[model samples]
Target: MRVYDVEGFPNPARVRIALAEKGAVDDVQFVSVDVMNGEHRSAEYVSKNPDASVPLLELDDGTYLSQCTAITEYIDGTYSGASLCGQSPKERAIIHMMNRRAENGLLDAVGDYFHHATPGLGPTLETNQVADWGKLRKSKAIETMRYLDDTLKSRTYVAGDTFSMADITVFAGLAFADFAKIEIPAELTHLSAWRKKVAARPSINA
Candidate 1:
């Protein structure tokens, strides 16, 4: 298998962390996508992934997969490790629910604010700037932080007792928030603490 991505990007980071968690990072080939140069948006790249997004997975059987969630799910299922996606029906549902919340609320929200309101990827890529909508999404991202803080007060991880893909999503979301200059409130102690704990994980620390 091969993974195409740009290092340090939030979405790519999620898939990389998932591979690390499964101890499968060494087993796969990682191809760097020149996102800064807009290589990901090129016509040839778009053919394989219509979304033209980084962190694309090309399976050995000649199947191409895009989207961080879908790529991570494939990696989780293919490798023998503690599952990132859940093992049971109910667990999968809960993990997916929380993962979506984290992705939509924090990660994607921060991304919208960065690309729309700010000079994200410079003028070359961020052609459609909507300051007002981006500002609104920035507020949404912060609101999600507070919600996550409250939720984390009771649960050890985002979805439940064990660390799952939902936890990875939240961690990357918070990292993206930092990069986008969206401050996670100091008053959200639970969130801050949980972030610190997650940061220390082998998958992240590595």
Candidate 2:
């Protein structure tokens, strides 16, 4: 499989972490895509992923998987190691719920704020920016972080006790937030604590 992404980007980092956890990092080929240069928007790349997004996975059989969640699910189901997706139906549903919340509320919000409100990746990559919408999303991202903090206060991980894709999404979200200069309020001690634990994991080093 070939995974196309940019290094140091949060979404790609999520896939890298999942691949590391699955012990499949060495099995797949990594191809760097330069978003700053509009490489992702090129026709050649768009043919593989029409969305023009990074962290895309192309299977050996010539099938391309674009979304991070879909790629992560494929890795989790196909490889053997610690499962990032939950094992049971209930666990799966809860994890998926939390994962979507993390993506919409935090990660995607931060990205919107960066691209629209701030000059994210500069003017070359960011077009048609809406300052008002981006500012709104920035505020919403913080609000969601507070909600997540509350959720973390009662559990060892997001979506109950085990580490799952939901946790991965939030971890990547927080990392993206840092890039956007959005800080988790100091009062969110539980979220901070949880972040510390996740950061120390060996897969993070990958």
List of clashing residue pairs for candidate 2: none
Please write out the lDDT profile of model 2 over residues 135-197, one tens digit for every residue.
Answer: 999999999999999999899999999999989999999999998999999999999999999
Alpha-carbon runs more than 4 Å astray in model 1: none
For candidate 1, give the lDDT of residue 86: 97
In model 2, which regions exceed 4 Å deviation? none
Error of 2 at 140 (Å): 0.9
What does candidate 1's lDDT look like per residue over 56-120, in tens digits?
A: 99989989999988988988998998999999999999999999999999999999999999998
Score candidate 1 by TM-score against the native: 0.98
lDDT for every model? 0.92, 0.93
Instruction: Work out the TM-score per prediction.
Output: 0.98, 0.98
Residue 26's C-alpha lDDT in candidate 1? Answer: 91
